[model samples]
Target: SILSIGWAQWILSDLPQDSLSLAMTHPEMDWPTAHAACPVLALAGDETLAGCVPARRRRQLRRARQAASRCGRIALLSASGSPQTFLDQLIRLHNMRWAEQGGGVLANAAVEQFHRLSLPLLDAHGLVRCWLFAIDGGTVGAYYGFHHRGRAYAYLGGFDPAYAEESPGAILIGHAIAEAIREDAREFDFLRGQEAYKYGWGAVDRWTMRRVWTRS
Candidate 1:
């Protein structure tokens, strides 16, 4: 006997006693609606939206200096760079500076909260991810957006408020462009933002169009 069953809602009333019942709390679908819906939970692979961030690289200050000798402004490139790693370490260092300036102690409990809860969310994405931080250094700000695979994106970033004058955000993004090139990603998406920093980086306006789907 050949039987074809199109499973949709679960038999909650008869949830199995064993581990099989764990998946019983399922959703219902209206066939006609399901057929027409083009929504989040059903959308296929993200071929167009995904972006990959290149590997961290080092920027040679000397090359930059040398380039300045010839061009209007010299550019330096480094492949052995780890901005995320550097940012993480810088965060602790800056926190001390903050304390020295009477920014209040970085309560151990507050840090613990970030490590346990915030960091987890940032690291959950297999393709795209972010880095969290406590503070920033004088030159290098504490920025995150650490690791990503296919179509990686810079989720969020932060810096030492005192260095706000330095535009740490701009520096982080400048380096980010090089990293994105190294990754050979199709696009470098800046998630959502209409901030000046986004514009300073020469990023253009792009919409994340959403589609609603429902089952009849």
Candidate 2:
């Protein structure tokens, strides 16, 4: 199964005890569990990114900025145009990075279609926050997220590996966090991952549980 392929955990913590009744109603169906770990950055009142991150990370961000600056100018563009215009570039950059990393959800047709349709609606409601990073007039990275109820969720992001030494992705994320702080967002959620990099950004672990119900 795809879940197995992805090494997902099968949790039965919330499954109903009366399995016999469930079997009578629906038979031969197998259930799978969904797993996720959300890494969150709690923002203090009017805190800046420099204030939120550790001193070491602050230094790293500073150095990254310096390295990237030599290429010309590093610009962070967000919600500056129609969602339609941004989606194509966003997906293209995302796919480019994912392709280099083996593969990702963006490679899936359904997921691609979902973003293509959902971004417009999210943008219309001002819930969507999309950002692109450009160096010397060349697009290098993109981030798509949602801001709602005083929280900013970092949904997805991608950067060209060709600029890996410059760390454009990290630079873009730092700017996004700074923007969220300026907007007075209470939390910046790096949704659905326990990746090591999230911790470097001063994120704390918030685990999400899942349950699978099976008929016997």
Expressed as tens digits, the lDDT of each residue in 90-134 for candidate 2 is 777888888967776687889889978988888888898888889
TM-score to native of every candidate shown? 0.41, 0.79
Q: lDDT tens digits, residues 1-216, model 1?
A: 212444433223222123343433323411111111111111111322123211121133223233333423322222123434543544554564466565423335576456445554444543333322222212334444544543436654555555444444445555555455556544455655565544433355554332222222
List per-candidate RMSD values in Å.
Answer: 12.8, 7.3
Instruction: State model 1's lDDT.
Output: 0.39
List runs of model 2 lying over 4 Å from the truth: 1-35, 45-47, 211-216
Model 1 regions lying over 4 Å from their true place: 1-140, 146-150, 213-216
Clashes of each: 13, 0
Clashes of 2: 0
